[model samples]
Target: MSAVAESTAAFSAAASRELGEGTNDTPAIAALRSEAVALSSKKAWPDSRKERPWKYHNIATLDLGRYTPGMSASNGAAAGVRSCPVTGEHAAAIVLENSDVIFSEASPDGLDLIAFSALIDGRLQKLVDERLGSAVAAGTSKLTALHYAFLAGGVLVATAPNSEFKEPVRIVRNYSGGGQFAAPHTLIVTGANSRVHVVEECRSDEGDIVVMPAVEVLPGPGSVVRHTVVHRWGTNTKVYTEQRMVSERDSEFVSLQIVAGGGVVKGHLESSLVARGSSSELYGVTLGTGNQHADFFTTQDHVGPDTRSDLLFKSALRGHARSVYYGMTRVGLGARNADANQENRNLLLSDTARADSDPVLEILTSDVIRVSHGATAGPVDEEQLYYLQTRGIPYEAAEALLVRAFAGQVLDRVADEALRDELSAVLDARWDSPE
Candidate 1:
């Protein structure tokens, strides 16, 4: 077998061994496990050479055999990791370490918070079965299939009908221990006429580890959902994440993504408006330094009439870092009067830094109201730099200032002032300007 195939088999063998120890393998989980095993047993990696989506992000070169399943430490806590920045002062928190739930809080009145295993065994089993893997179909990719097959502890949150939370629900996941793999999932369901906000923060201590996570959001008719995600893995880590949100009639969904760390990071985000008058807004920002590689893929799918979507993604790369962004807006035949727009922009801070952006729109209905997409990858604006320099700022500081301003456009759009300020501080610490 080739090296990739060999590594695949090794990872699968390790996962199977870990599955033997998990305590919450319900019938639904059992079915998923069987499907995942069948697909992964093929020992085939994603075909980057033939697939357009995989072309920019290549994982075939990595040796998966080097990493084993992440096991809970004897201490039962994530050591050397900082406490969750999002405290209970503003939101309830769920803490996970190595895919194990270490701490969690009950949601405020009018909402139910449970574990994924409990969700499957309770009255919501049908709902979970119907929507669990719908957004990210299993067996489509090697890692995805493996994730489902070896799924561990995850959070399940549901809001009651017409209920509105005063604060966001926060989930803080910290990954530690070197040479291990952690896969966690999150599912959020909003009832009719309900409103909620959620924030997910992911980080890792120093380790050469792999963290793969998936999140799915289902909004009922006339519901509103706002979610924010921040990922700052250690420099020795690689991250692969899949996130999707599906909106029903007259619902609104918004997502903000900020990525700043990891040696190799790949993320896929999708939002679908499946009923009339549904709308979605997606905003993302990425900052890369050192030799980091960051890749993001996004899709805005409109399947019903009078639906709308807007997307904006920005990136800044320095040193030998590289970034890639692929965005698409698809309007189905029944999506008459649908309005969709997408834009991607990147800034290179050094000669060796690289960026690639692809934005496309697929309009199947001629009766659509409006649709457009655009992308730009270029160096920092010389004029902006010169202006800052003329104000007595050093060249390096000037460049950093310009880069910060460029990234702040998306940051300023965040609704929570506290969360916005916290992210801004992190940006200051992570943003690297060429010396």
Candidate 2:
């Protein structure tokens, strides 16, 4: 067998040994895991030379055989991880450490927050069974297949029809220990006419760890769903994240990703407007320092008539950091009157810092209202820095201010003031001390 296949087999064997140890695994779940392992065995690892999305990152250097699947954390093992609320007030909150739930608050009425492992025995079993893997399938990529094969702890968030959650639902995940692989998944299903917001935060202790996190959102007709994820992994952690959303007729979906930590991070964020009148808004912010690397691929797919989407991603790099962004806005042949826009901006703070950005648009229909994209990467404007310095601000301080303002453009678009403030604070903290 090839090296990739051998690694897959070894990891699969390790996963199988601890497969249903601490959680309920129904036959369906077991079958899904087995199928994922089988699919992984046939897939080759991504080659940077051959794949556009993998071009900036060297995936061959990562040895999957060196890391074993993480098990559930023992009681009190999460003492160092706190479950503080990011948005001040929340309808529900769950704290996960090493892919194990250590603390969880009761969900509000009309909202069901159940562990993915408990789905088979819970009241929302049927709903989860139908929608669990609908938005992001395991066969989407080789890494995704591995994610499902060793899937350990996950959560399912389901909303009742016509319900509204004034407060956001929060999830905080913390990872520690060395040479371990962690997979955390979240499946969200919204009912028709429902409105909800979800906030997820990720942190890890200083260690060599691999994390594959996936989130899939399915918005029902006329529903409004918002999601935000913050990455604050340790400097030694390698992270790969996948998040996708599918909007139904007249539904709206909004998502934001904040990447500030990790040794090397790569991921895909995608939104599909599958029904008429559906809309989506996507935003991302990345702050890289040290030798950190962050790479992302995003897609805005308009598959139905009168669908709309807008995306903005920004990155600030310092030290020897690097950032890469590839985005595509596609209007299907049947998507009449579709409107889409995409933008990516990068700021290089140091001479050695690097940024690569590509924005593409593909429109099949001539009846589209609008389709546009823009991308830019460069160093801090000397004129702006001089202006700030002339006002008695130190050069370094002025540069920092400019960088914050550059990233603040996207943060200003957040709908919730409280959440926006919290994220702004996080940005400042990460910028001031990016170690």
Candidate 3:
């Protein structure tokens, strides 16, 4: 095996010892993996594509049964995202721990929560099942297929129409691996005229393993939904994350992603405006030091009239780290007067560190209001350093200050002071004294 693969196997072995002993010993996880095996062997699947002239399509399918052991829990975290949670609540809180219903709090009254697996149990899984393989399939790509074939956690939340949030809802899952695989799924659905914010965080404890995440969201007219996610699994893990959302008339959706720690992170975020007057916003930030590598890709699909979208992604790299950001916004032919923008900014802290960004736009509308995208990469501003040191600040502190500033644009949007400060410290800790 290649050195990278060998190291991944070592991590997975340690994770197996601590997170899970084996699938046979974990019934819930075994069942989840069995489902994945079934999904991977299916052959009647059709090619994925955009149905309309303005719809954006950039789907990559992979086979899941081909999963290989990795140095960390990135794979498990990514797979965990594929499973849906089954909390018994009415407003549908995302569940963790394999068919375990942990959230018993009084769900916001008038809201409805549906478990994806329950659909498999009750025979209503069809309408959605039809849309599942198409959203982010595992047909040929191991990254995606493994998520579909081996879901261990997932959630579907449908809130009341025209309601507002008194507090942000939070969902979190922590994994301490023991040779076991886990999937945590989450789904958000907002009623017409509703407004609310949601957050999801995942942390793995002490073991290097595999993880997956599969999320689906739907927002109705005049409704608003905000989302934020943070994934931190030690240095020897693998993770796959998938997110797909549909917005109806007058609805708005916003998402933020942070990957401050992991071995290899592959994430996909895709949003489609199903009706006119809808808007979608996708944002992300990542930090990688050491031998870490992360890939983030997103797409904004405009299917309705006058829809709008905006996306910004930023990353900071040090050590022997590597990262990639690929994003695009497409305006359908019938979706005129659409306003869309994309931006990707990267920071490299070491000469051997690497960062790559691809920001693309596809416009099918002739009378669109506006469309633009750009990417930039440069070393720390020498002028800023000179100004700081000349003012009596030490060189190392000045450089650290500037590096922290480079990451601030992302840090500012975290919305939670504790998380913001925590991420800042993670960035600050990576700088070395330049004597």
Best lDDT goes to which candidate? 2
**TM-score of each model, paired residue for residue:** 0.91, 0.94, 0.74
User: What is the Å distance of residue 399 in model 1 from its true position?
Assistant: 1.8
Candidate RMSDs in order: 3.0, 2.5, 8.4
Instruction: Score each candidate by Cα lDDT.
Output: 0.79, 0.85, 0.64
lDDT of candidate 2 at residue 220, scale 0 to 100: 87
Q: Judging by TM-score, tell me the better candidate of 1 and 2.
A: 2
Model 3, stretches more than 4 Å misplaced? 1-36, 42-104, 110-143, 414-435
Task: Write one digit per residue (lDDT tens) for candidate 2, span 3-33.
Answer: 6675665577456535645456565666677
User: lDDT per residue, candidate 1, 305-402, as tens digits?
Assistant: 99999999998888888888888899999999999999898999889999988898888889987898888888989888898888899998898888
* Model 1 spans > 4 angstroms off: 1-23, 78-88, 117-121, 124-130, 432-435
Full candidate order by TM-score, most accurate first: 2, 1, 3
Q: After TM-score superposition, what is the CA distance of residue 339 in candidate 3 from its true location, in Å?
A: 1.1
lDDT of 1 at 319: 86
Q: Which prediction has more favorable lDDT, 2 or 3? A: 2
The segments of candidate 2 whose C-alpha lies over 4 angstroms from its true place after superposition are: 1-10, 78-87
